[model samples]
Target: MIAVSDNLPAGARQPTESGDCIDENDARQAANWVAETLERLSRSSFRSSFTLSPHDAEYARRKGRELIDRHAHEMLAQRVGAAQPAKDGRQTPWRGHPVFTAQHATACCCRGCIEKWHHIPRGRELSAQEINQLAGLIMAWIDRDLAAHPAVTGERDGWAAPPENPKDAGAEQGGATPQPRRRSDAAGHLERSRRHPDNHHADGASGFIQGELL
Candidate 1:
């Protein structure tokens, strides 16, 4: 795995309000939190299992980072930013978008997971700064996934070559491609139960217990 520090440019610290969420404006702290969080997440089999499929990686490349980041922010804000999201734990789907997978892998999928893994408290709407931090982390994961899988851009292994113009890439695909099968609730519960005992904790504290918030 590429070191998280390698992906981010080093910068001097800046003042900010005290909070558990990483200060997105502080480049150094954000980089460290991302690196540490990723490292901790890697120790969990479930989190490590999530990856950007060739198609998803290609989709991200075509959409460009700006659009992907926008999608992440929008999803996070709509699905998770609310204090009492309509469905809470069931809000984020197990598939359909790259950010969804990233959310699961990074433990940013629900309020419970966010509180446990990210130290972001629940019972109140996520602050704008907190939302930005979460978005940054999600984007960092996507960036890492893309960097790790360069073959997605090449015309090999059933993957199509990237188009010269990103906007034109969608038309080249003909139409909207079908997403992979969504994970059934039963399957998700089963997987979580199977992996619960093996979940990794940060700082020796207990890790997220799947279905706890469901």
Candidate 2:
């Protein structure tokens, strides 16, 4: 979406010459690349701020990894993966789903971010292998977040279960029900990043690194 200059950072890893198609060796290399990339991304306060809410974690768990993987493919193909997407930089939302959060956290939300962070080039449609690799990266982030905050079982503090039939239960017994914790949006951080260019690499302790998958 946003077409920032494609100037790679100093000491940045070079993009592979294998084009868009990734081979077995590429996959192995990609694993290491993803680890290093995520670490660098975690240094940015804006990028590390995105995390899945309990509801999102529950949804991912209920849907299973297979469905989540499918969603990754569908989302990548529809929202990204194209040479030039419909909205480009603004195509991805900041919240509403785990995958969306993962995209932001992992820098897979747009073409510019993808190229800047993952060494993936722009101006051409992403290959199936490339899409898959990106999807894998997204899933890896989601999995880590889910694992970091295990599902809260039983009744949470200050949360009360609602009656099956509120009307039948009568107004006397009805009481206020606590809402689920909402996932935080990084819009403020994004804006800060825009105003303060140096904010992109601001020093911050990221929880993701500790829970990163091997």
Candidate 3:
């Protein structure tokens, strides 16, 4: 993981007063809206539709923070001049985080989605003002999920630890095998849950915004 810079450039702090970042009250309001939407969706036949899998939720909570901290400035602050595809064909800009899945699921994954869902236009690069606002919006969605499901995530165990020896995997003396926690390392790039593999598809420049102001 790239080391996150502690210093944000000028005008990069989360909004406090009625500008970029959503204050506590604003976050609460946004969370409430999402909760309500979820509640309504839960009542429908597609009750299981919107919720992330437990494994996916855990991965998102952990890696989303890492991805945001490591790359949000380059993603949201600067201009995306062209689509840059990695070796595997996933666009470099938006790959590697379940947050993009959340963004796609939440209609915040690309500039087109931003335009379609939030009335933000394309063509021009987002200003730092807009960048912080959108970043806060994505964060608010993540915060709401974590707030609702606290047990799903906690401090991550070391990702770099070596695997247990195969001979020891079966346990020297075992009556019944314990169900192990699902864990995964993505070709050494990211550690995630094996049950829920990383959804690394980029949303391109579709959603540069996330969540709607209430």
Candidate 4:
């Protein structure tokens, strides 16, 4: 990933209250919003033209972050007319993450399918709660911007978000999976199960926001 400091023009120091990461949370929220917006863009017949296989999703998931690293480097310059930082030291850039386009390209195929898609990068230590949180953030974002989601509203009006993987969609279509499943109880649900993938994100942008707030 690009060094947070590099994002500033030469001589830009950390904000007096908060340094280089000033816009980091804003970056995460905007990136996710952009991602949901990407999903709504999927109605193109070209979508069918390019269905991504899980293997490909795996490949992208494996390589995407490295790509994020490179793009982050490219994004190091000044905010392209972003809003000023918040009073509490929050930075919210208007342009969103440069990787949003790239992320969308990858997400088109991976939509609702892979649980692994939610996995933290290979070297990170993530908890289940974190992964769910990120997933929630991703979904919550979609809820807010349903109208803003291009795939859903633009030329691809019929385009619905796809399952993250082909197999999952296939199971649903073919009825291979059981139609009915047990309703999960809240509170104890997470407690009884093994760790969830999103716990990482709870540690991720989602968690950072809640945890730091708490």
- C-alpha TM-scores of all predictions: 0.66, 0.62, 0.42, 0.21
Which ranking of candidates, highest TM-score first? 1, 2, 3, 4
By lDDT: ranked, best first: 1, 2, 3, 4
Model 2 vs. true fold: TM: 0.62
| Error of model 2, residue 157, in angstroms | 28
lDDT of 3 by residue, 1-214 (tens): 7887766565454444234564456556655765665444333221122333344444444444645433444444432212321222222222234344344344445455455545667666665555545555555555555556665223433212222335433432111233334333333212321212223223343212123211
Candidate 3 or 2, higher TM-score: 2
Worst 10 residues of 2 by lDDT: 170-179
Residue 10 lDDT in candidate 1: 40
Best by lDDT: 1
What RMSD does each model have against the real structure?
9.4, 14.7, 13.0, 19.3
Better of 1 and 4 by TM-score: 1
Model 1: pairs clashing at backbone N, Cα or C within 3 Å:
none
Among all windows of ten consecutive residues in candidate 1, which has the lowest summed lDDT? 196-205
Residue 176 lDDT, candidate 3, scale 0-100: 25
Better of 1 and 3 by TM-score: 1
For model 4, how does the per-residue alpha-carbon lDDT over 43-116 read when each residue is reduced to its tens digit?
32221122222232222233333343333322221111112212211221111232322222222112121122
lDDT of 1 by residue, 65-139 (tens): 766777888788898899988777667766557787788878888787898778898789998778777888898
lDDT of 1: 0.67
